[model samples]
Target: MLSQKAKYALRALMMLAEAAPEELVLVQEIAERQNVPKKFLELILLELKRHGFVFSQRGRGGGYCLARPADTITFGQVIRAMDGPLAPLPCASVTGYRRCADCADERTCTIRKVMRRVRDAMADILDKTTLADVRGGRVDEDLLATVA
Candidate 1:
């Protein structure tokens, strides 16, 4: 499950993605449009800006916009930036792997095996699905085939 922060971040990014090119969307506008709290969205946008997902301008007519094209930013990147690794278990993680403390032999651990497959599948889908896919308002045919 995505954390509330991650969900908000995605919502905010989606709004920005749909904006006109180079248009700066006000933070208050994003908060109200997405139904996210203004204060909480400030923190989330700050974090996203730090990650190079967004850039902001100041003064009159100032606000935030995507640092790169929406098609280049994957859902996995945003989620991972907000929530760390997508893996359910540390032992199953690829980027943030940690051995189970109680497991004497990870090589034969059935739980790890199942979780690794789960983690891989999740990564595959999220990493392939970009904000462009979402903004297009239709499922990718290839992705739909894979899901089906």
Candidate 2:
């Protein structure tokens, strides 16, 4: 399941991607615009900044912005940076591999095979979808609502 925290992060990043390239937006502004709780959004942004996805400028006209161009930032990167692993099951994850202890033979497990396919599908979609896609308003909310 996608946590509310992860949702907020994606929504926030989407808004930031839409922001003017040279214009930094304040955290409070993002919260208000996105309907996100201010304090929680603060922590989320801090985590994003820590991950090199965003940077903050302190001052009256300061807030946060993407550290690099949106086109270079993948949805998978943001999700992984904030949500840990993209896999539904540990055994399904390529980046954060963890086999279930109960599984006797992961090599021959039917469930493992299905999960591998699921993970591959997820990786393909997210890796190809960049923040630029979000900023350009190319998001198919229908696709996002699939796992919802």
Candidate 3:
């Protein structure tokens, strides 16, 4: 399941991408346009800024913007920055991994093989999807709005 936090971050980044080559956009504008809560979106944007996904400006014209071109930033990078890993099980993850204690034998477990394939499939998909795709309408913007 995608966390609300991650969804907000992706939407906000997409907004930033759309407005690129323009100046920064205020938090309130991102919140209002994306339909995300102002306060929560502010925190998520700050998190992204801290991770170099974005840069912030403070003053009467204070706002946020992407640090680089949208096409250069992959969805996998944003997802991992916002939510750790894409894998369902930590043991199957490459980054931030933890070996499972009760595994019959990691070398021979069929489930492990299946999970590895699942993880790689997920990674391949998300990695290929970039912020450029999100802003260019190649990816569905309604994904964030569809959360129940």
Candidate 4:
């Protein structure tokens, strides 16, 4: 399940992507526009900044903007950055793999196999779908069905 924080982060990033390049958008504005709490958004943006997904400018007429182009930043990167690994189980994770203590033989674990497939499918979609794709207003029924 996607966390509200992650959803807010994605919404905020989408807003920034739609803005003019290098345009500074205040956190308050994003909070108001996205209906995300101001304080929580502040923390989310700070985390994104640390991850190189966004950059902030302080003082007068300054705020936050994307650190790189939207097309280069995928949903996978943002989600993984904010939500940790995408795998449903640690044993099924490629990036954050950890053996389940109860599982005696992971090599033949049916549960792990299914979860790994789920993780891969998710990664395939999210990694290929960029902030650019979202910004383009291309939310077709097919896309929605696939993700859903």
Best by TM-score: 1
Model 3: which ten-residue window has the lowest total lDDT? Answer: 139-148
lDDT of each: 0.94, 0.87, 0.84, 0.92
TM-score of each: 0.95, 0.90, 0.89, 0.94
- Compose the digit string of candidate 3's lDDT tens values, residues 14-80: 8899985547999999999899999999899989988888889899987998998888888889889
Ranking according to TM-score, highest score first: 1, 4, 2, 3
Q: List the candidate 2 regions with Cα displacement exceeding 4 Å.
A: 140-148
Which regions of candidate 3 deviate over 4 angstroms?
A: 139-148
If both were scored by TM-score, which would come out higher, candidate 1 or candidate 4? 1
Model 2, span 1-148: residue lDDT tens: 6789888998888898998875698988999989999999999999998889888999887889888888898888888888877888899898899989999999999998998898888888888788887775677676577546
Best by lDDT: 1
lDDT digits (tens) for residues 15-106 of candidate 1: 99999878999999999989999999999999999999999999999999999999999999999999999999999999999999999899
> Distance (Å) between predicted and true CA of 43, model 1?
0.3
Residue lDDT tens for model 4, 1-148: 7888889999999999999999999999999999999999999999999999999999999999999999999999999999999999999998999999999899999999999999999999888888888894666466688877
Number of clashes recorded per candidate: 0, 0, 0, 0
The TM-score that candidate 3 achieves is 0.89
- Clash count, candidate 3: 0
- After superposition of all CA atoms, the RMSD between model 4 and the true structure is 1.5
Which stretches of model 4 miss by more than 4 angstroms? 140-145
Question: CA lDDT of 142 in candidate 3?
Answer: 48
